[model samples]
Target: MKIVEQSGKETGQGRGRALWAAVAVIAIAAAGVVGGKIALKSKVNELVAERGGKAGAVEVDFLGRIHLRDVTLPLGGRSNARIAAIDGRPKILFLNGTLEMTGLDIELPTARILVPHASVEDANLDPATLTELISRKSAAPLAKRIDRFAAKRVSATEVAITQAIAGSEQKTVYRQVNLTDIANGSVARYSADGASFEFAMAIPDGAGGSKQEVMTGSIGQMTGQDFDAAYMARLYTEKAGPDDKEPRPLYGPLSAKAIAFSNGQARFAYDEMRSSGFSMRMPAEPLLETLEKLTSVTNPEELEPEERRAFFGRLLSLADIIGKGDMEMLGLKIDAPAKAGEAEGEKVKLAVDRMALQLDGRRLDAALHGVSMGEGGDYVKFSEASMTGFSWDSTLEALKKMAGLDEQQLETFPFTTLLPEFGTFRVAGIDVNLPNPDTGADSTGTEGYADETGETDALAAEGLMPDAEQEAGADQQTNQPVTSMEKPAAAVPERIRFTLKNYELALTKPFNGIPTDIRFSYEDLSVPVPAKAQDETSVQLRKLGFDELVVSSNIQAAWDEPSQNLAIKDISVSGKDVGSFSVSGLMGGFTKDFFSGDPAMAQVALLGLTAREMKLEIEDKGGMAKGIKFYADQNGMTEDQARGMLTMMAAAVLQQLAADQPKLQGPVDALSRFIAKPGTFTLTVRSKAETGIGAFDLIAASENPMLLLDKVDLEATAQ
Candidate 1:
């Protein structure tokens, strides 16, 4: 179908001529009143008539406003757009146009878009620049050209979109959209009022039916910036390998506020961003500094390899900025029904009533509530799970301490040095409850055990219990006579403090500029104890014991820079049920200066540690002796034989202590006296000279130890 062209001179009828005439008329008007508004309208109507209704009707109102109805504008032979109605004033002199349309629809071979209403105004754009930008084939060139163009104050309202895929349609909508000052730098913002999206997602439903998911959320506002083409490309574009090319950065910064979205089962939102006044400054200072330095060098690649590594090192330091913000979620859940081959009650469901995250300065906190199991018999659930007061500033600073080093130096630097300086990590509340395992018998195996291979505990027991003669022979070989079988000690309750109401760990940076003061504590801690059940695999939580088992440690150590020594002022570990213990020492001659030449060698030199005045105090409530006897009895020995074996072991240990320094005999006698008692005992051991004991001796007891009683200095007392 060809369109006829109308002009001052009669033109031939053809699609090309028709399009050219229409463009020429608009261009003339844009070029400043070549053909009057009336003439332009007539030409548009003429082209519409020539299209034989394929192009809808065009009319000119008395007020010189162009009116379009059911207008179909062809984009070559591939696609076209249908405008139900268009009413607006077109300004040619200012190269600006304002238009409003209703029922605007676009059609393509595989897709279609519909817009109920759209209004664009104050759009000042240069035609030639737009033509040049669109003509470019590559993104780099397109972005570069876009840098020269600017458009402002363009807004659209109520946009509806639909995408077709494999016989299904996915729909999305936006309530309002705006573009402000797009050019070298521009901002774009959009908003949606609890927009609803619907889609059919394929899932493993019992009947193989697609699941209908509806996501509803109010996208309050989202804003983004478009800088220059090169900048944006550098920030967002990624290229692969030999075929890849460096890209220019385009966008600047992007932010979203009060953003939320959720399908029926899961919900995600940032409700706190608005209500809690959340704001953050991303750590970018180090990166900015590095880039600023590079600006003086025409090409950063031209710099030396060492300089390049230094630049990269600086960039990584920016990651320590430590943002502060708050986030939250509501009604998040996951559900999966039992499959055909799965057992009953095998379905899984996990739900959380609410979850929240908060960051203030260097501290990070999180909270969870109404946490419950939806499937698998609800074994574990906690009404609340909260973790608060954790600081990262100290840790980051410790890491940054190595920032200025070269790549090789950094590789050898001990990153673990930063581990102990995490400032403080605290969790004030964690209350969890777990029920007994299921006990119903199944065809697979016994109740609760659920062994698929038909294996039973009796089979396992047979392998564990040896014949009576074999047991007797084992004891006889060791020359240890057993009067009676030793009842096994009860399993110690887990020390994890699962019902921990509060916990804390901290390593403080002293005012003296050295790592000092380490503190750890646990309060209101308890462990669950399970009772025997008919099914070996299942046990019911009969009671909670070990209550009020408070444990605390406050260790203070300092470096004497002049003497290159690490002085331990105090180190203690104490608990309510366990005896108190303390250790103090002077770790002399650390050789910190000797390793100053190389970081790698510095780590090695740290091993050259010598200590003096090492002291230890233990206040035991006769528990140590009982523990020793119990352990020996487990090895098939009588109570008397266990005590005799323990005495020899103690004497053997003292020999090693005396070998390091004979003066340790005093502490040796003190230990002996404490071991001989069956009541409360207090034992104290101190290094007689400046060199109290060797590190290896204290850590790994010595062999072939030499003991001398003349230089002993120790004390032990019993009550």
Candidate 2:
């Protein structure tokens, strides 16, 4: 009985002690849980504050993962203009080094965006530590800091946006925006699908009224990839070391499909657009210096006028970024009414299968294929056209050096002022169709244009002959010329005078330069000559029935003072169906002192000096003989009559030459024989002595015209 009583007492005491121990452990664990929650809440609040958001606006919910709701972000220190109702479900995977945010939503009164899912991979930096790194002052470049932050890859899928402006009834909606491996990847890809945009604006019409313009468009899909953008941006924007040869190509590829735009009246549709290998070269020393100066200024307005000019000049210098790339568009079409209100006249339709442009440093090439345009109730077509070697680098460099551009002067300089200084350029296969002004009855010049020979008969009746009374009346009317009594219209000077002034300013300082050759040539150029008065020179030329006309020129000019020489190497005008002619010459004995005076006076003096030593040779080949015969035939003249007319005209010209110089009578007679048959003719003239402008005046005033030619050399040949 005594042993049983003792055992029961000990068991009860042991149970009581065990119960107390368990209670103590539970209390300690509950206190620790509360403290941990408080610390997490404090940390989240600190983070929100650092990101410029109010802690009270953020709501935290822990349902296995972290969730935030109803966060407000101030805009430009304006609490009223703020981003409202931001919500997200974010889970931090510490072991995997990732932050996955799902169902993220952002809202504003005018605009709203929702991102279904976003994830940041390789997010190894702690939030607090990242905040400190960002907040701390450092001497490193902003590019470098950004590079460090971009070490992690961020991806977002299926982002949609809707926007509505306050004063506009239009709404814009964009859907399915996806970004993958945005920061660090071989190619960071961004894409969006099914985007609709609307715009409305009022444009001023020439007459005081306003025209309302509305535009609407849709993007079926757009995809863009920046090939190693983060890396290349760091390399190009950041300062380079002495050993760096050149920055690698900073390039990307882009593609878009099914873009359609319309402005109520006209519509444009493109099936697809692609741009590949777009690149930019890092600028040179001058451009770099300008960039550095720009960075030194916190406010652009603080810069002086000169500094601003210099900055802008340097910036314009870089506008030709010297990159190479290719771009292409497919299935482009344009449709519009040909006239303002006449849909029945002709609805214009233009279509092109493909258009492409390619650039390779200092060289450009472009091509278009399957082009067709509506013309005169039918479509004019072009299979393909291309051009190449269009560049302006060297000319721009020369202008820069000649202008003596200082850093300050370059800031606001307009580089287009130098456009007039560009060198030679060439283009091929350009087809231009000038709209005919006389498309109605005037184009046919007679009723029943479709009838055979009606136009020629009408022209013959109207233009070939005139009655004696009418001719007499016309002479009497012309004898008394009617002059306008109204005050002359004041000439409005062109706005381009300012640009010309800039060019003159560049030339204020003398620059000894090399020879330059500039020419522009086009092929298959055809233009119809309209009906003209009987006195026009081209009226006779058109009667020759030439099918087409081509105009081409080649000029080589040089000025050298030390060498005491000025030369025009060659100037030629050649055509396919028309005749060809050329003039070339040289002069010597011009010194530097001759050009040291006022430019205009110097030019006059130079011309005088050149006139003393000038030598010119003029050449012609079968130029006007065929045209003359064609005209005489069209005028119903016999072959013999045409021959007689040709001979009489030749004799008259030779007689005039004889009047100028009896010493050239033999040559003049020879030239007449040369024109009698289809042959080439050449004339050479050389000055005899040093003559000034007074000599030309004397020749002009001389009653004995042949005496002037006798003072110089003249030679003519026919073969």
Candidate 3:
């Protein structure tokens, strides 16, 4: 009986000890849970305080879930942000979570943006690294920290932004915006739908005054692909080193559809627009800094003249950051109603089928297709126009320089320096149609110039007619005043038409704002002319039996820098069923001073110019015969008589010319033969002096034609 009692006591003692140990373990776990909650809340408050923010009611649950309410944060400068509530579910120690934010609002000095709801799914975040990145106090590479960020999706609903610019308010609203597959602080895709904006401001009225302008615009959809949010953020927040040359793309491709804008005076619309490959050549930090400086100024107008100029120069420097990009727009149209005092049906209309621009480094290439302007029967249209290899480097530099000039200096600024360099410019399939100048309804017509006899006044009043002797001769032959030679007004056309197949200009080399190697040409150009046109040239063309002028011309010229030589390779103009004329010349003594961008300097340099050699050729297809017939009709004589009279007159003039210098005798004889027979004629002129004739000598010879023969060697032939 004694052994049994001892065993039962030992078993009871062991059970009690086991129960106490279990109670102790439960107490320890309970204390740890309370401690973790308190610690998480404290940390939250601490971080908010560190960023100059305040947080109200922070709560943490046992599962590491967090909730915060009434958050207010400073967003740098004069900007502040507020959040109504934030909820986060942490998968690992608050380092990653699904976060939702509600009632978010950001207020700037003159703007405010509001978001009703925003959310991020499966977001991986590091608070410490993010803090460092935002502060920009660390020297670490942006990619390093940005790479640590990732999220499956981020979205916002019903975002609104309102801004006040120049005392005018503007508001923009977006219905739905979202980003998907966000990783490395960048987004694989982004989209926004149903965006609209309205604004009002005062703009220059182009009459030394300002006018109130109201504008409204809308976009049905906007989308971006592969947007580098992190790099862009870094650019705005961090200063780049001098050696940062690697181009960083801001986005892969972006597009907008159903875009439209309208002001009180005009409406603009486009079916779609797209852009891609926009990058930064230099660092973006400078641009950011400049913007900051500009915005920080309380009253920019109060600044000194020099200070204002410096600020403008800094502003212009921002363009240097652009590296390369391309943009295209389709189906663009603009319309403006006729203004007061304008004629009916005179509304302005412009349409473009497509337009595109590409920027690579400092070069820009642009093209326009199917462009038309004006309304009613008066319009200009072109199938295509393009410009390639337009470099903005010099243009930007010139603008910056101008920006730094004071008012006094600007008055005398060398504007020629602002001319930009270009590779090639071409326009094809151009058509222009307009009412005849003479018959136009406007009072600027030729009615006031008519004489009492219903005949147009003599062209001699406009210095268009020949000398008095020739005028008298023509009048005597026709037995009437020269003014009566003009066709009656009833014979004029109602409208004029002009068309061109192509026009092109190529500047292979440009130096000091002048083309050193260039080729300019136009093909298949045609313009109709009325018989009674006021211009002497048009009258002559009509008298030559041409109802329409159809011609093509080309000019190819170049300058040799090393040798100081200017060569005009070809300057040719050809008219259909008329004739063709060409001129080629070589000159020396051209120097850089000729293009020094100063008018005075250029004029001074022109005095030192020298002419070396020149060649002129003319081929008479049928123009010569038409001219002889017209002269015979005007002079009341036969064609043969007219041709003989012209030949004798030319010979008589040549005999006088040969009196001073015998070198011109051969050329004069050849010219007489060409006139009599209506055949091809060629003339060549070479400088007699080894150094070529100076410009001063040429100017002097202009007063005494005989003097020019002494300075040039002449060759002429008729075929």
Write candidate 2's Cα lDDT for 51-82 as tens digits.
Answer: 67663344444421233544544443322222
Candidate 1 vs candidate 2: the TM-score winner is 2
Q: Which 10-residue window of candidate 1 scores lowest in summed lDDT?
A: 536-545
599-683, model 1: which lDDT tens digit per residue?
A: 5765666556654555666666434554655566567787677777787888788778767776666656666766665444454
Highest-scoring model, TM-score = 3
Q: Which one wins by lDDT: 1 or 3?
A: 3
Maximum-lDDT candidate? 3
Give the Cα error of residue 344 in candidate 1, in Å.
11
Q: Which stretches of candidate 1 lie over 4 Å from their true place?
A: 1-85, 90-98, 103-114, 120-157, 161-171, 175-190, 198-326, 330-426, 436-498, 503-522, 528-607, 612-719
Residue 415, candidate 3: Cα error in Å is 6.8
How many clashes (backbone N, Cα, C below 3 Å) per candidate? 17, 16, 0
